[model samples]
Target: MFFIICVVLLLCYFYMRPTVPRSPSCLVGKTAVVTGANSGIGYQTVLNLASRGCKIIMADVADMEKSKLDIIEFTNNPNIFAKHLDLSSLKSVRDFASEILKSEDKLDILINNAGIGTAKNNRTADGLHPVMQINYFGHFLLTHLLIGLLKKSPSGRILFTSSLVAFTNNLSLKTLNFDLEKPNYFDRHFVYGNSKLSMIMAADIFAKKLKGTGVTVNSVHPWLVKTPLFTKIHAIYKNVFFQMYIWLSQCVFGRDPWEGSQGLVHAAVSRKLKNATGKFFGDYAPWRKPLKAYNKQFCKEIWDASEIYVGLTPEERL
Candidate 1:
């Protein structure tokens, strides 16, 4: 009887998984900046914000023309514009932030959704690890640089795109060197996980820093969605027997990009969660308890290390 009840409850939960609706209420008269907006989860998130009347700024490393075309296909709204941002490059992040500052006075929502998960063990133009720089440090720089603009809004929200891998993958700060030092393939998972862990820590630090400033900061684990972002991994892993494993895993855990982005949108606009700052959320609710390493001291250390690595002190950026 208990087993049957558990099965019924599980079935209901799957049957009632909440979908991201085109609600006109969440984003009326707002200005939102979304990174990696050209494709995957970022693309779906951009569409969601735009559908509710938010003026959208789509930033990505991809060509502006390509991003613009994608936006056109997704939404015919002219309020949307595309900009260039290579999150792996500190200079690129600075340049993109500068450009946005020149054009927009205030930013209501800044979604740091751009990320890379390839196993190439690469580095950016900057000498930092490619995944680390792109996933965490870049967003760190961008957010700090634009905190003033975000604070210009009545109540700004900074949403970071973190992942569940942070809890599962092992990391050590000694292996901080870039592509040349790390494994090119199998070990890429740890790098990805490290970057995401850094992201969550950064978000927590930002939230604490902006406590009374009305600029809330948070991070989310958008589910493992099957998007073009995973094409490389999927293609590489899709062999005769691996395909079945991938399929079964995805069936149980993966979701579409739109579904994955719900937590982000919820965190971005939900007034009921006004006190949700600094908290890590997944599937649109506060994570029960963050990993032990996600404590305040770690966040501060990561912040200091990041500032040192990026050569931008908090006062200097201000």
Candidate 2:
């Protein structure tokens, strides 16, 4: 009986996942930026906010013309625009942030949502782990640069799309330097875990840093979804057997992108959470604790090191 109940519960968890309710909260004059807006949950989140009449900026490494047109057509909300952001490159991140600061007076929402599932050992032009840069450090820099603008709004929001996989990470200041050095036995299963954890750690830190600014920093575990993220990872391998493994895993663990994005939209616009910050939200808004969510000293050490890694100037320090 216990075994049957466990199986039933798992099935229900997957199939009966809640959708983010339509938020009655008004966003008439707000402007939001979503990285990874080219596809997956990021795309869906953009659509959700656009429908609510928030001016949307679709930022991604890809050419956003087609996706932008599609969202505009569907939402009939013409305020959506596209911008380029290549997170793996520090220069690109700075350029993007600079452009935003010069053009937009203030940014109301910032979603650090671009991510990948690749496990290949590689370093970016910035001499950091490509995965870590794209998933965490790049956004860290962008957020610092844009902190001023976010503070302009009475209740600006900065949401990081962390994952349950973050719980699996075992990290330190030393291990975090995976740009040239690597974590022991690094592979696909563990490649993305640490990056996710770093994001949550960042949220913990920022939630404190922005305490009096009325700027909330929160993280959400958007749940597993077989989005093109896995499809892109599949292209990384040539062996038939490896491809099959990837496909089988997604088949068992993934949900639709729309469903996976529910937690994010809920975290983004839910009126109930207007003043909430430093919270780690799970699928559909259940509170999920972050890994070492309160390790302030460790997070600060990593933050200082990250500032050096990202080449932030003294004046840029927040």
Candidate 3:
């Protein structure tokens, strides 16, 4: 009985936690790119930024015509544009970056918000694990390719959407790319957590390297929100008990997508955080003291390996 009561109290606390409020500052003429903008927190972030008069570029793998229409109609802003970007494919990422560089004069904000939670082991066309490629490597490369444009802005900001699991999971950087010869060794959840950890580490590394360059890099945990990612999990678990557990958790802890997007929005444009960089944010505030394992050495190792994995040329190194 006591355990049940404690669990109930915890659920209530999570449910009632306050979200970051939208910024009142105008972003007129500022340009931003948000990956995975078709749905979930990414979609909400686009709406919030568009409402504030920022010109938005929606980057996603699938067709975003519907989302673009909805955003234009809802925000009453026609500055939203769509671009094709398949994070799983290195070639696609390069092509998307090239087009953006040629077309847009400047990139004021970049939100690397696309991610996936896979239930099965799979490899992308780039010969890396699907989850790792989409969640970490692709964004790593895209950021590097666009650093020039980001630097052109007065105060550029880059935001990565990480997760709370990164703090608790035992991430093995050595096994980032699961060996195809040993397919049996792959664990879906572990790989997913490692990918998120990589994002945090990469953000820290970029922030350090970009010092005095007028560019800020940060990562954020959007909290638990009911999004399409759960549909994949539901398909993986068919047991009655597991299904019930998922339902209970969502009902108790999940916030609406807009509420979940607050931390990301705050990191992107909040005046309170304009000068903050190399930080992890949650609940619309800085998350201090991440695990000691996420050290400078580890971050450097991951950054170097990512450069090779993404085929970043020497000319592109920052």
Best by TM-score: 3
Task: Report the lDDT tens digits of candidate 2 across residue range 40-106.
Answer: 9999989888988999989899999999999999999999999999999999999999999998998
Query: Which candidate do you rate higher for TM-score, 2 or 3?
Result: 3
Give the root-mean-square deviation of each candidate in angstroms.
3.7, 3.0, 2.2
Candidate 1, poorest ten consecutive residues by summed lDDT: 170-179
- Write down the TM-score of every candidate: 0.87, 0.90, 0.93
**Cα-based lDDT at residue 241, candidate 3:** 77
- Best prediction by lDDT: 3
Question: Candidate 3: what lDDT?
Answer: 0.86
CA-lDDT, candidates in order: 0.78, 0.83, 0.86
Tens-digit lDDT track of model 1 for 92-180: 98899999999998999999998877645466668788778877888889998899888898889999998888875555455444445
Q: Rank the models by TM-score, top first.
A: 3, 2, 1
lDDT tens per residue, model 3, 288-308: 635743577766777888889
Per-residue lDDT for 207 in model 2?
90
